[model samples]
Target: MSTKPSLAVVERLYLADAMGAPLQARLRLSLCAGQGIVGDRHAGRRDWPGQNLTLVEAEEIENYCLSRSRPIDLALTRRNIVTRGVRLNSLVGRRFRIGDCLLYGIERCEPCRNLGQRLADETFDVPAVIHYWTGRGGLRADVLSDGAIRAGDKLEIVDTSGGLA
Candidate 1:
């Protein structure tokens, strides 16, 4: 894999009151270390560690649409940040910065039945949703610093080691 610091821009930001709830688009969001997006349903919930934030690439959605012959809503994915130009999968176990906030990629945010259930009404093939997003769902991250992130913010890979880690 290439060690070059991957660069991307935040394309969209979303938040919701609770799990499985419709997402609300935001131009900006406040995040805290050890907590998720401030005011988000999962914020401060320790039950699921490393779930402080979730990210999905816009390209993934495009690819899914092309492969499935249907369009999927970004909000339905339940990811906090929708990015463009960054390979989120490669960031797993790495540290990255979005705006002023620092985040550590914890794991792949694999698609789950819950996501399928949420799209049940709008989609006729829920399994397809799961299938398409299985490994491309996105990445789960833990906030390392408190700060504000906004749409159009640039993403930068942080060098944790003396060189790329």
Candidate 2:
């Protein structure tokens, strides 16, 4: 099986620096950069630097995207960065090249209890047990390039650092 990152598209987009914030309910998932993608929805936080993933957990995001009905152009979060066509979890312990930027994948983004609360559906248990999630879903990447990322930009995995076995 080929182990490459994939993308999943959503009919709607949601953004917010904080839970229950106006930014949460008002954001749209349309194809837009700067205002939506590649920037920080939660820039000021010392914990989360860029936009984060919401629906798909880190290890499972790519798989979820692959099985999705339509091709998702990008996945944007409350964090500062936007990812396109790249599965964040698959890049764990690997380095991704986006233009002049090179980001190192740290770990899988497990889902949080907050997700269950936010979703109000509590369907995370099934995926979590399958190793698709750990509880909170998302990823953590250190910024290599300080520029804006859009939907069409290419995401290349340069090195796996003994990863992707």
Candidate 3:
């Protein structure tokens, strides 16, 4: 059977401990990007294509951050994509096709001290998750087609070459 990976829109997107310019997000959660369209808000540099986490990571981080009264919440993050049914870690080295765009599985979304602070508990295995997912957190893909991507868009695993690597 094929791994049916699907995407969804969550009620919230969050940015933990972000103290710089406000990021822009869409309530739609997913957006369609066509040729010449900007695929990521922060695309370029080492953090190209940006980092995105699954709902699971967000929930875990939210609980940890909220307990510590940290300032990481949906209102703060403007993530363009919120995925469901797809584990951020499991996608490592895999190839994902969303609409006409393609992405390479890169890494996981790790929790930072900012996340711990946002939780207000300051006591969680934030480091462990981070360490495990570093460089393997979130799938980072170079724009393949720049097609319009929107919330509820379907993600297809076109290639399984990720596991071999």
Candidate 4:
């Protein structure tokens, strides 16, 4: 983590109602711990944590757009939350909170090459896409507490000690 991670704000929120459906931007999301976001397509599919929530850095998205020299929508990243002012990768294995929801960062949300092909333009190719989103994709987290989170809500690191029982 070269960049010092700090408090972040949820810059954008999105949800997909069904498989392969387009991401719909939302002002707020009702999250169910261990069940995922209410009404979201992937909500009840997982019987575990890790994937209950997904977040991507707005800054990284900006960097990718700059590298590709084209404006890409945040929704296309397919992450549940878009955070500003934090290095999300640094949060892996740490406990954080957005609104009243507590979450454990399980792993890095790696880039998808298929989405890369779609994002790639004439000048930039798939290789460039991989190069850009390799480590900057986002985060996959396990929700620890059920709560509602809004787009403008603050994301704070509540525990970095790995949540000792």
Candidate 5:
């Protein structure tokens, strides 16, 4: 068995008013178990249980920008949290704590056509973006405990093996 300790911090947080709306930055947000961010478009939506929260690596965004020779806004990714210094893929099926909230990593948050559409612009290359982001899109989580999370919060890996033991 191995332990993946807390190795990252929440660099940013965002929420959208609706499905097609632009993401707005927030200093903090409330989360409820089995539900998403309060006031978020997807909150209380049963269709995506694991999507209670979405997270993206800050490194992935930096890489995407470097590869494309430009900067991409964090909001365009549609992820609720922009994190730094953690291997999010390694947390799949794992339990992690973000600030006061406890969450279960459900699956990888893959880039979709809608994401591409939202990010499309004269300087944005959809295919290239998708290709670059492939497995690095981020993680979708199911809130296991209700609490408030804020920017600068640390992600602590509570169960590294994701209960495989």
Candidate 6:
């Protein structure tokens, strides 16, 4: 039997030096165990729940953009990782790996007014975007292992079952 786990692909990686700074796309992200994504705004931050990392589905963002007749600038999505072909919310409470980094999914990242304000511009309004992204926002995860996670890396749920001899 194959030991491979259910997998998902990391589509894009984003990082920012500080809060309110525009996020920059990166080819790889350095994850610090028990910390956060290196060089990211939330790195070393422990105050926020599930603040180690954030992930969202690219498909959901695309759908939202399509519905609003506006193109997406994924960086504005505010997620540290943009993934495809997986349901992030379902991974909550499960352990997973992306490249060499192991992580624990913590909770659903609920849309907040901060994100609403960020999405608002002359092109769109804040409240509408906030409500529109309700359940489709993203997932919050805790970094469990230190490693480099790159764009295009496969995300696999780690198996906890001890293998039988």
**How many clashes does each candidate structure show, in the order listed?**
0, 17, 27, 0, 0, 0
If scored against the real structure, what TM-score would every candidate get? 0.85, 0.51, 0.54, 0.87, 0.88, 0.88
lDDT per residue for candidate 5 within 1-165, as digits (tens), equals 998865699999999989878789999999998888999988888786476889999988877767667666776588999999898888889999999999998888888877776556687767765766779999988999999999999999999676321
Worst 10 residues of 1 by lDDT: 156-165
1-165 per-residue lDDT for model 1 (tens digits): 879755699999999978657789999999999898998988998777577999999988777665656676666577999999887878887888999899998888888888777555455577876776788889899999999999999999895442211
Reference-based lDDT, residue 103, model 3: 56
Please report, in order, the local distance difference test score of every candidate based on alpha carbons. Answer: 0.84, 0.43, 0.44, 0.84, 0.85, 0.86
Give the local distance difference test score of model 5: 0.85
lDDT tens readout by residue for model 4, 1-165:
497656689999999998778899999999988878999988866754566788999988887776666676787688999999878888888989999899889888887787688778787788887777888889889878899999899988887665322
Runs with alpha carbons beyond 4 Å of true place in candidate 6: 1-7, 121-124, 159-165
TM-score, predicted candidate 1 vs. hidden true structure: 0.85
Q: Give candidate 5's error at residue 132 in angstroms.
A: 1.8
Candidate 4 residue 62 Cα shift, in angstroms, is 1.0
Scored by lDDT, model 6 comes in at 0.86
Task: Write the residue-wise lDDT of candidate 3 on 19-100 in tens digits.
Answer: 3446455433332222122433443224433343222334433543465567655432233344555555656667667655
What TM-score would you give candidate 5 relative to the actual structure?
0.88
lDDT for predicted candidate 1 compared with the true structure:
0.84
Q: What is the alpha-carbon lDDT of model 2 when measured against the actual structure?
A: 0.43
- Tens-place lDDT per residue, model 2, 48-78, is 5333323233223345444443343334223
